[model samples]
Structures are given as structure tokens and as C-alpha cells.
Target: MTPLSRTCRRLQDSLNSFSNTFIFIFTTSHVRTSLTPTSSTPNSLLNAALITTYPPLKLQNRKPFEAQIDDSLEQPKPIEETAFDALKPTRLPSNVPLYSMGSSSSPSHTIPVVSTFANPFETSNSIDASSSIRKPISLWPGMYHSPVTNALWEARSSTFERLLDPPLDAPPQSELLTKTPLQSRTSVLYNFSTDYILREQYRDPWNEFRIGKLLEDLDALAGTISVKHCTDDDNMTRPVLLVTASVDKMVLKKPIRVDIDLKIVGAVIWVGRSSIEIQIEVTQSTEESSDTSDEIALTANFTFVARDYKTGKSAPVNRISPETDKEKLLWEEADERNKHRKRKRECKREVENGKVDDRLEALLAEGRVFCDMPTLANRDSILSRDTRLENSLICQPQQRNIHGRIFGGWLMNRAFELAFSTAYAFAGAVPYFLEVDHVDFLRPVDVGGFLRLKSSVLYTELENPQKPLINIEVVAHIMRPELRSSEVSNTFYFTFTIRPEAMKDGLKIRNVVPATEEEALHILERMDA
Candidate 1:
């Protein structure tokens, strides 16, 4: 036998020996009473053992022995020290009749002996399973216990088994977008690296990887990076909530194919008092290496904010100092972007109050040099030839996050899908995702709310008719059924490139048509911004 098998055999033999020794002392009195006074008692107890094998004598109205067992045996001990106790019955209820060992084997008079020797060499797997068996180690409540092996894993971070058999209360996949950062005294940063192939399952009708899935991953990665940047050694650093504030300058350079290994990496580029900017880069390679020959597929910048998990108030984060030249450049750019964003907000407020600045009015004039060129008028003329597309749906529970609200990724997906459809129809051929210049999530959408997504061809460049480029605007609004009103939730700006056609002679392209001056100005403002 193998050493393990031998050891198990020895352990079983010891358990049987211990049980027989313990039970022998308790049943000796009953054995002695079975012998008649005329019988000669053997000095060696071999005779007593022989007598126990015989049929028990009937005693009319005689009560069974009520022997009191010492409580010392019941005291808790280490599993190794009290292994034999596993063989004993846990409860001895009064309703079960106790049988004498010295009983007949006949059907009417048979008495069952709790046999330790009969199964001494039997396989351990043959033992009947019962909850009464003492566990070698105790586990916390709600943890799973195996019936076959009686083994358990550590509760912390052990979601592998639970994932296989998920409970109804488990959080949706979107809830994993942001995870708590590991506590550390080192530099505050996050690095995300994941590889994906353009599998058929992730493709759209055109057999290209869906831009929505890419955006979803980007949102999740950005959220994780934000959480990592916000955490520090401060005792007040509670679990912080993070959300995607904006996605900017996301460019897709090449079409992703099923054969290419798409590698995406994300890292914290800059941090503000309560905001974090994460730069995520997507690259494709024929082979796994650090070779420069690898193709650059896409690049994106994402902004996220740390908020109080409970009150939803903005929370401050630790500052990051730039050490590298690239970091320094990005830090400066982040500051400039923040300033420009503030100025844009102020400009919007001025426009909303019907107080346009002289400079803006000059920029909007009918005809002059660059300062007085009627850009809005040109934008309106271009929008006069395009078709608009729209889609709407009621938010469902499946799209909800752990917070019981629609996930930002899901909203981005809906918007991107509609935008793709609009671009495809306008291009008269397959349109590939080129870039998402900007996407801003304005407000959270509650579950069961009506979601309206509108897409339009904001601009198109067909100067090179062989290769046309189209820009689309996708807007999301949440509608309240009771109020009969809708509030804007998101605005997505996307750019797409149509497949090149062999045009011996150039083809004239149709343009987007905006009817109102407000629409024209809105398009012009975004272009300038």
C-alpha cells in the first residue's frame, strides 16, 4: 500500500480500537447480568466474551440499564485528539430502544451491535454521511460546505465557486467596473492590461468588433484607475464610488480583426482635487512581443471622479507629481483642458441668458475675414442634405448596476449602436469606427425610465470621394412618463470612415442640413471647442 493509504489504514484501526475499548466498559454490567449464578465465571474474561455472543435471556418487565456516562468524554478537543468521537451517535433519544450486545440473531430477537470491528478495514468512502460528524475546522455562516469531501475554502476573495452557482443577490457584471484599491504607502497609480481577440461573438453585422464593447471596457478600466488614484493611507479613506465623467479624443486607427491580438493598457495620467484622467491605449500585434512593428489600433482619454459612496458628494484625492517628461506634458494639458472646460461652461451660461459676447457675435457674422465669417450659416447649408436616425427603449433591470441605476457603459453602447446604424445608412457601404471625439454623461438614468437616442450626420467630408469621412452626433435623453418631459443624459460625438471606392471620377456627396440657427450654432460651437 502507498504511504498515505497505510497511514489512513492505521488511523482507521486506531479509531476502531478506541471505540471498542470505550464501548466495552459501558456494556460489561449488562454482560455480567446475562450470566446465571450457577455458571462459573472464567478468570480471563474470554468466557464473558463468549457469553455475549449467545442469545440474550428474556426478563419479563425488567428495565434496561441506564448507565451514566461521564461528561469528560464530551469536552471539546482538537480534531486529531478526538478523532474516534466521529464514530459515536451524537444524540441518544429516549424513543430509540437500546439493544444488548449479547442478543440472538433470530428475526424476532436480533439486537444491533454498534460494530466498530466490522468496518475497521472498510474504505472511508463507504461511511454514511451525517451532519453529526465533527468538522476538522469550523466555517463562518453562509459559506458553502461540500457534502462529498466536507471541505471549504477561505471566505475572502473566493468568488470562483460562487460564480459558478451565482445567487440572485449577486451584483451585475457592470458592478465590477470599479474595485477597491489595495492599501499601500507607495506611489498612487493604476495599470490595467488586458488582451482580446476580435472574436465572432464580439462582432456586429459587418463582421467588425463592436465599438460599444470597446467603450464598455474603456469605461470599466477608467473607473478602476480613478478608484486607484483616489485611495491613500488616510483613515478616513472609505470605499469611494467612481463614474465615467467623459471620454475624449478616442481614436480608432485600423479595423480590428479576429486574428490580431488586441492589447489595451490604461494608466492614470493626471489627477485633480477630485478628478482623475486615465489614458488608455489599444494596440494590435501579430505576435506577443514589445516590438515596435506592432500596429497602433486606438487611443483614448477618459476622465473620472471620486465621489462619496453614500452622499454622492465629490471627494478629494491625493495629488500626483509628474516625474517623466511625458507625464509633465500631460499634466499641463490636463490643466489647460480644465480651464477650457470652465470657459465653455461660462460661455454656455452666457448664451442661455441671451447675452452673447461681441467676439462670439463677430465670429457669427455673415461675411468678412476669419473674424466675421458666417460659420453658422455654412454649417446650416451643409446640414440641409442629411438624414437623421433615432432609436428609443425603456431601461430594463438587466442594464442596471449595483446601485439600481443604468450603467454608463450600457448607455454608451446604446448610443454607439444607433450612431453606427446612422453612419452605415449614410455611407451606402460599411462604415468603420474612427474615433469618438467626445462623450459626456450628464445624468444617471433610473431603472424603468424611457431612453431616447437620437443620431444625426453633423458633418461629412467627401473631398476625396474615394475615401469619405462622416461625423455623427448621438444624444441620449431620459423621459419621465408621469411628467411628460425628457432630460438630456448624454451626448456622444463620433467619427467614421467609409470603405474606399475606386472612383475614376469623383462623386458629389450629400451634406447634413440643420434647419434652425440654434442647431447651426450648436454644431459650430462643438467644432471650435
Candidate 2:
């Protein structure tokens, strides 16, 4: 070989040796320290580590070696590895060198080595990788995915996620790292896009979005808004758990079409001692439409209560002050709602204490409308009712939330569907959703418990025969095995507008007759309220 060719070969060999050494040094020296999230580490220390280890490959000095290799010989394959891959834990191959920062007696400074293929069932309690640990991802077949790596990615993404508006170009990292009070305290805007009607798994050839799915998104948004409101500029307070207490005055105005952008704006409208009311407004827009207007498709007021993570007691949050006329009105409205809730609680306690007034008793004695059969054997009563329906089922895991319980919105969806069926059968027409008067979550429903839902017509206005106003009541009960009885968990009130002209045949409706004073009083209480 010529002298030039021999020199080129020597340079390529030296380059390969340097590449291997560089990978080994970083992988062994720093992998353990970087296993945990960098968020917990000091910013200066993290910056120093990044500066020391970044760009392991020096590409600027490559041109001399790049042209020296003969075209006839096979070129070396480019290194497709990344710095992140070195951080991934894998089983120690036993032949690999055991690394340490100092002697064994001074173990505090040792560089801990961990395997990527740790047991999936083992629990990791500490961020210190100094002591090797963990569990198998799962026992089921094909369920051995690495949760450790997944968690690391999630932590990294959340810490560095973009915080600016979508349309605006992102600023430099230096600008983004310096967060301001205004950035911390801002209304959260959530945008979700889906071709709901065209996707086979998500849709059923329906043009409008599913009420259940929409409600789930709303519940999630409510929690997000609550967190955003409760968060402070200091970052001293950690995120607290918030539960949905009630949903009121949810009005579905227009049908949300397929392949549309469902935009939601959620903000804290009112705050009480420990509970906050978030107003979530949903609007539907599409890329094809020229209408830049924001038309609300649905809107609801959701009340949530923050709970201390450790004590599980009601936690106080920062109070909000109204600055604008609209804000003042919402604040007053929320105050009124809080007062109403307090009054209802007091009334319930009064009834439990046997301090019922004579006026309430008199309302019970008056002839009131009810839909329940007088007796289980009363076939005539069942046949006469046209606007009542009942169904029962066991709550399964599929309907459960991360809290391991059935979601409030799932119950609402069930109630709405049953009520719509009853209304459709009675009116002999298509029932259009108007509004949800109230969805009071009295108690949490267990995942595996028997859920019994009863939907009945509370009131119907026949003054306008063509267009009738119907109010439906839905009550959910969970069967208590130990007590041998069912306890009420939730009550949903829905209002719908239906047209009698849409009926195929002439359908005659019969008025509901109350079988007992208690049932009559219950119906009357809802109607009067």
C-alpha cells in the first residue's frame, strides 16, 4: 500500500478507539447520577453536567478524515446511538466493569450501577440509584415494558414543555426558563381535534360527539383548571387532589360535527373556603369553515373541592377577587350557589333529625305526580306509565377512573340516555338535549357494586302541544350488601325539548298518579324547586 493510504488507515483506527472510549466514560461515570430526573438537581449542577458531556462526537474536525478513506473499501457505519440510550438501564452483562467514584469503605460517593431489565413487580421508593432496586412491569404476557424509563420521559417532558401560545413562535430557551407571575397565573386553553364520526373505533356513524366522552373531557378540564387556579407564583404549594362535587346548568346548544376542533376555555370563576367553581365553555370550529366567530356549543359550571394529599381534609386555596363587571356577576352567582348548597345541607340535616315542618307534610298530602308502580304486582300501574324507565348493572373496571371508582360523568351519561329513551317513547319524537339542571354527586360509587338507575318524568308542559317542555329526574343507587338495602348516591335532573309532530302515529300520554305520600312528596319537592 502507498504511504498516504497507510496514514489514512491509521487515522481511522485512532478515531474508532476515541469513539468507543468516549461512550464508555460517559456511560459509566455519569449514568447513575442522571437516572433520576434533573428537575430535583440544582440548576447549576445540571448545567455543568450538560456542558461537560454534550456533543461527544466532534464533527467539525471530520473533513480531513472523511475524504482520506478509499472508496473501494467498506466505510465505517455512522453511530446511531444517542446520549439518552446510555441512560437506559439494562441488565449488567457481568463482564462489564464495575464503576466507583472512590473506595468501597467510602461508599457514599460510589457510582451506582442498575439494570434496565429489573423485576417489574419491585417497588422503587427512593431516587438514589446507589442502591439497586425495582419490580416487573406486570405478570401478564407481553407486559414487561419498562415503567422506569417511561416515568423519566414524562418527568422530563413536563419540566421542559412549551408554555407559550400556539400561534406565536417559541422564544429562546433562556427566555423560557425565566418564568413570570403572569405566565404562572393564566387561563388554560384546551384544544382537542378528532374525526369522531369517521373513526370506526370512536364513532358509530353519528354526526355529533358522544355525550359521555365530552363529559369525561370536561371533568379532566375541570381538574386542570382547579390546579391552575390553586397554583401560586412561588411554587411552594404542591398540587392537591381535587374531586368533582357537582355539575350545574350544563346546556348543549348545537350539535358538534365530525372532524371539528373542540376548543375549551376553563377558568376559576369563584372560590369559597375550600371549594372552587370552574366555568368550562366548549366551542366547535373547523378548518373548512370561514366563521372565525366563537360560538359556544356547550357550557357548564363545575364545582370542585381541593383535598390535602396527606390528611385528606378540605384544603384552603388562594381567594380570587373580581376585577370586571362579568367577573363580578359570576362571583355573585357563585356565592348564591354556595348559599343554596348550604341551605340544602341544613334542610337535609333537619329531616334526618325529625324536625320536618308541617308545610312539607302538607305538600306530601296534596295529590302529586309520580311514575313508580304502586306495587310490584300492580301491572296496571306499570302499563299506564309512559315516561319512566329503570335499569341496573354492575360497575366494571372499564368505567372506572384513575381513582379506582366510577366517574361522575359516566353516571350522568347513563342517566341522560335513559331519560332520553323515556322522553322519546312518550313524546313519540326526537328528544333534543336542552340543559342539565343539576347533577348532585352525593356519594362515590364503588367499581364492582350493583348500580340501579331510575329515570322518571317530573313535569311536562302541555300548553304548547306541538313543542313540549319535559323535566326528567334520574336517581342512582348502590346496593349495600352488608345493610341489605340500596343507598342513593346521585340524582340527575335533565330538561329536554321535543316536538309532538315528529311522532309517526298518534300517541296518547297518561298523567302519572302517585301511589304513596312519600313518592308524591319527592316528586313535588323537585317540581317546586
Candidate 3:
């Protein structure tokens, strides 16, 4: 070979060696420190370690060796170059708080001042350095923001504050409007697999993604969608107050992995004169290819009631005009759900008024038989009271929503965890979440109030022996000691099932019998529903 060609060949080989070394150093440092397995390491972390090690090797081969050599000769670049130059950590001023956008002179260092939710009307020059108000940072489209951020933003907004407490004489209908569903559609992306800091914020001790955290995000997104649907202008003086009325259902279609990027998409599906229904879906793409279709991980429906901020009465919201067939179908489904909710409410009233159908009567009679004649009851069955588990704590400000009330999603998360524990204790196996049968936000919980959560494995279905279903109920009560009062704040029903693998140990769940007429009524009601 010619001297020039030989020289080029040597350079190419050296470059290849350098690239490989670089990849090794980068992967080893990050994976060793961040992805190291602990005693409590989850399966997902193991998979993440494997993924982190191999992907960069393929990156080195993106361009041909000859091409790289030609580029190197033209540029005469240094040998110790790195791909992470853009990622060099910024060293902020010593006075500036990390992860905070607060005033440097502010006395308080506890609460972070996130700029994403800062008051839109306030400029940096106009901000009072001595003020303790937490401002929001600018957020780009598709970026993920926590529920706290949303709350802070709302707290800082003059428009939202007006909505929260408007002038008593303010008109209920400042404007009437209609909007297409697409106009309010939003998608928030969580790049957990790629973003280290983001992953750390959401990663649980088990190295898995925290579903509770995601629930908070979902609620935040739903609230955003509701507000988007209600407002036509960015600078509205009298925006309507929207509060979560209920979470109709939340179904887990697939397990969410921490190593995968997640996208949460939501939009207003249907709107009544004073209510809105939103659909939120969580999806994840496979690591193998971004072009591959995303797998849906979860789906949920959130209902919000719009009220006049001044009068504290139901207020009309902008109607949604379905533009696409899918949108129309979603609207229809939401309508059906609305009808179902009404029917269920009427049924509940009937049961309360001592009116019952034949099927319900039969189920109630069967429940009485088990309660009245314990000796004649099946030996494999256990009283529902036996499957009960409970926990209580004071609701703190950290769990409050934009309205200053405890967030519905936080309540759901707490109830879900307790329900899972209840089922696990009853089944003696790790239970997989099936779905949230229903969630009722009967009363708003106050921060600093005594909150009690009671969970019970209401019943078990063994029709599918391989995957026995456990129906669990959780009741959240707000208690006041001074008045000796206890009122139900929320009701959550969740369904879980044992995996076939878990059932291989010859484990069988016993049927649960109602011990009282009240318990019997609950069982019959659920069965009828």
C-alpha cells in the first residue's frame, strides 16, 4: 500500500480503538455507579444495566471507518474528545440553590422555587427578592412537570386566584364558547430510560418506577386538560374553577418498566354544561426501535366539575365538538359512562330506601345464610372482617392539590397500596393489579386533618383457578377529634389477581362472607353493579 494509504489506515485503527475505550469508560462509570445491583435491586434495573452496556457500541459504527478517517484528516481533531461535551455539568454560583429558581437573597431554603409554573405576569426584574412566593419555571411542550409544579403555577397565577375567589357580583357566563377535542389534547413525555436526573426522581427503592408518582402526574395532566377545555384565552379574568369529582376507572393494561420512556396523552372527551370528562392514556415504546408502535400501559377516565368561582355554584363549560371518528367514539363511550354513573347512583338510593331487585335480594339472602349459620357455612370460607387491614395518618400539606385540598390521586395511591397489601395478606402471594373498579371523591380532605384508610378483601372469585381474582375495597375517612366526628372522604375499589406462577404452589383463596347486614348490602351492591 502507498504511504498515505497506510497512514490513513493506521489513523482509522487508532480512532476505532479510542472510540471503543471511550465507550467502555463511559458505560463502566455510569452503569457501575448508577446501575449497580443492590440487595433490593429489581429486575428492571438488571435489564437497564444490560441495555446501557451494549447500545453505545452500536453508536460507534454509525459512520464508516473510512469516512471517520477522512473527517479526522480534514479537521485534525484531538484524540481525547468525548460525545458528552454537551452534557458537562453546569456549576452555578455558590449562592444559587440547586434545582431552585428562587431569589438568592430569600431566607427560606426549604421549598424549591421551580420556574416552570411562575406567574406569567411577573418578570424577573419585577419579582421581589424578599418575597417567599414560589414561582414556576417555563415549561416546553411535551415536558413532564410534577403535580407540585402544577399547584405552584396555579398558586402564582392571578387568573387562577380570581377563579378561586372571584368578586361576588362577577357574572357566571363571561363568554360562551365551543372547542374541538384536539385543541385541548396534550402529551407529556417522561424520558426515564435516557434522562438520569429524571429517572432518579421517579425511581423507587426497588429500582422500579413508582406508580404512585405517575398517578400524581396523571391527575395533574387531567386538570390541565380540564382547564384547557374551559378556557379559550390565555389571559382570562374569570376562569371557572374545576375540581376532580371522580376517577371513573383506571385500568393497568401492562406493567410499566422504569427503563422505558413513557408518554402520557390526555384530552377532553366529553363535556356537560357544568362537567367535563377526560381520557388519559400512558404508552411506552420498545427500546429496540422508536418506530415501533407504542404499547399502552394504562388508561384512565377523570371527571371534573366546573363551578362559578364567585357564586360557588355549577358553571357552564365550553362544549367539545368531535372532529374525528375516534373522537366521536370516545364521546359516545363517555356518554355511556355518564349514564351508567346516574343509574348506579339511583340504584344506591334504591338500596338505601329498602327497595331491592330479585337478584340482589337473593344475594342478600345468601349472605345472611353464611352469617346466621356459621356451622353450615363452607369450611373454606372466611368472614370478610378477617381480611380487613387498616392504616391512618394525618394528611400533610405536601399531598395537597392546586385547590389546597388533598389530591385525589394521592388518596388513590394510598388506597391502592393498602388494597394490594390486603389482597397479598389474604392470598399469601404477590398480587398483580387488574383495575381500579371505581373511585369516589365524596368529600375533599383537608390538609393536616386526621385521615384513616381501611382496606378489606371484599370477596374472591376462583372461577379461573389459575388467576383467582381478589376484589378489595378501601374507605378513606376524615376524622375530627374535637367534634368527635368521622366522615367518609373517599371510597376506592380495586381488583387484583394472583399470577399463574404464584398459584403453582397450590395456593387457594377462600371465599369471603359478610358478617353484618351492612357488609352484606355492600357485597350485593357490588355484585349487582
Alpha-carbon TM-score of each model against the true structure: 0.56, 0.56, 0.68
Model 3 error, position 269 (Å): 1.2
Task: Give stretches of model 3 more than 4 Å off.
Answer: 1-125, 128-173, 200-209, 232-236, 287-294, 353-379
TM-score of 1: 0.56
Model 2: per-residue Cα lDDT over 1-529, one tens digit each: 9644564565456556664354332222233233244456544444344333333345444221111122344655547877545443333322222331123223232346765334534565423222224322211111121222223222222221211111123221121122222222323222225433233322323354556556655665565556556644332334445678899878777766545555666777888777888887777765545664546788888998876555667877667766668778877988898899789778766655666446555433322323332344333222223456899999976565434567666777788788878777766566766778867788888779899998887766556655567778888989977779989998988877764555335644434434455665565556645
lDDT of model 3 at residue 466? 91
List the pairs of residues colliding in candidate 3: 115-136, 115-137, 116-136, 116-137, 117-136, 117-137, 118-136
lDDT per residue, candidate 1, 3-29, as tens digits?
445645654564465433433333433
**Minimal lDDT window, size 10, model 2:** 138-147
Clashes of each: 5, 11, 7
Report every candidate's CA lDDT. Answer: 0.57, 0.56, 0.71
User: Which lDDT value does model 1 have at 253?
Assistant: 68
Q: Please name the candidate that would achieve the greatest TM-score relative to the true structure.
A: 3
TM-score of predicted model 2? Answer: 0.56
RMSD of 1: 24.2
Instruction: Write candidate 3's Cα lDDT for 155-260 as tens digits.
Output: 3354344444445554455667889999889888888778888788877665766776777778878887887788746343466778899887678877787877
